[model samples]
Target: MNQFKKYPNFLIGFDRFFYRKEHKSTRRRILSIIVLILIALLVIYGILVATNVNRYAFLSLFTRGLRDQKQQQDFITNIGIFTLAGLSFGFAMQVKIFNIGISGQMLAGASFAFIITHYLAKTGFAPAVGGQLITIILSMFVAAFVSVLTGLFKIYLKINEVVSAILLNW
Candidate 1:
């Protein structure tokens, strides 16, 4: 056999990596298809499980247990509140508004909600469950409204939102 014919000049370095036995490429292709099918099946299964109402019953029971536990209830509430605050802060930042007083705003909203709920309780105007719901709704609205006001002030007054928010908190 001529040397040139046996070893092609075009095959060199990393380019030669693609040169493999015929069966290797076929095996790889089959394996890739199998993996993709498995992944698709898993995603389908997850969607089926999530959409089924039976799964929600389990989740409800789990949530009820957490609600019955004072520590767990407080932990979850705190996490939710902080997560909302963080999201609001991020939104403010994206709009070129500084949100330096999220913590203070959250505290003030909670305090105001507590005061209102206390007054309602004393006046006998609010049922226990309804009062709790109103308190939560009012607190969330107050927090969101206060944050939006801070953003508006920053836009209208040409002042640093961070400074304005901090002052509002004080």
Candidate 2:
């Protein structure tokens, strides 16, 4: 019914690429997404304006820690610690297990490590790297043992891990 009808392949391909072939459905979806994003931005802008916050430095908080060497080291250490915990959680989830005792296990391990470090410091091993390494290994084993204990209870006692973990966490 038109001149472009003679070149069906090119017209169909062009329409699909430009999103003009979906009866405005594709265009409407994109337009809605843009509108929602714009709305969110406007709300954030309004809150910032109402608070009279310094707009120029509002986002500097995110990068301020990187400006200090010690803070950067602390940030990286925290990242490493959290990544290990996250990996453990992911692994448990993959095996159809919910490891809600993670927090308890981590706290117990840290406390054990602190006690070991304190004793080492008192026994002339003050700041010894080897002692620190041993302390870390011991802490990891204690944590794993505690976590496995919780799993054992779930498997044998038929107790919900979440409920047991809540008690353990407390």
Candidate 3:
């Protein structure tokens, strides 16, 4: 029994080397080749960047100038709004609901938000920060609501979501 077990273990090792045809050296060589290719690609990219150093410098300067003038508060608010929109769409997808009217929903949401903001501004009851917050909240809510309504319509009316979504855009 001991001899039988030892013979099978030896044969397994032999099979790994000969039958399986996989060698440690071959694996090491493949790994080295991949590393070399990656290094070469990095070197080429560095050379290209160095050659166009001036052009890159000008582009960086132009972008930085624009960044300096952009309002930080507005940028933060926009990012928050977009994050909410993405989350809403992701949730819809998770529930096996298709939200093809995302673009139109977003457009209408923005338009409605603007209308609300202007109305509040005219009424003299809106603070600057408060108005912005309300606009962002309203935009996300309206957009998500519109997407849900479209999904419901598709399920209840047997209307194709794609056609309804496209027509909504028009």
Query: Which candidate number has the best TM-score?
Result: 2
Q: Model 2: residues >4 Å from true position, as ranges? A: 1-58
Residue 108 error, candidate 2, Å: 1.2
Identify the superior model by lDDT, candidate 2 or candidate 3: 2
Output the worst ten-in-a-row residue range by lDDT, candidate 2.
Answer: 13-22
lDDT of 1 by residue, 1-170 (tens): 77756657556522333444345677666766687677876676677688885756645644664665786878788789789888978997898656798987888788888899788779888767876787888888888787777878877987787787788888
- Pairs that collide in candidate 1 are none
Candidate 3 or 1, higher lDDT: 1
- Ranking according to lDDT, highest score first: 2, 1, 3
Q: How do the candidates rank by TM-score, highest first?
A: 2, 1, 3
Rate residue 45 of model 3 by lDDT: 63
lDDT of each: 0.75, 0.81, 0.73
Q: Candidate 1 — which residues are off by over 4 angstroms?
A: 1-70, 128-131
Cα lDDT tens digits, model 3, 1-170, are: 67768689788865554445345587756766687677876776677688876546644632444464465566667778789668867987999766767779989888988888788879887768876887889887987687766777688988888788878777
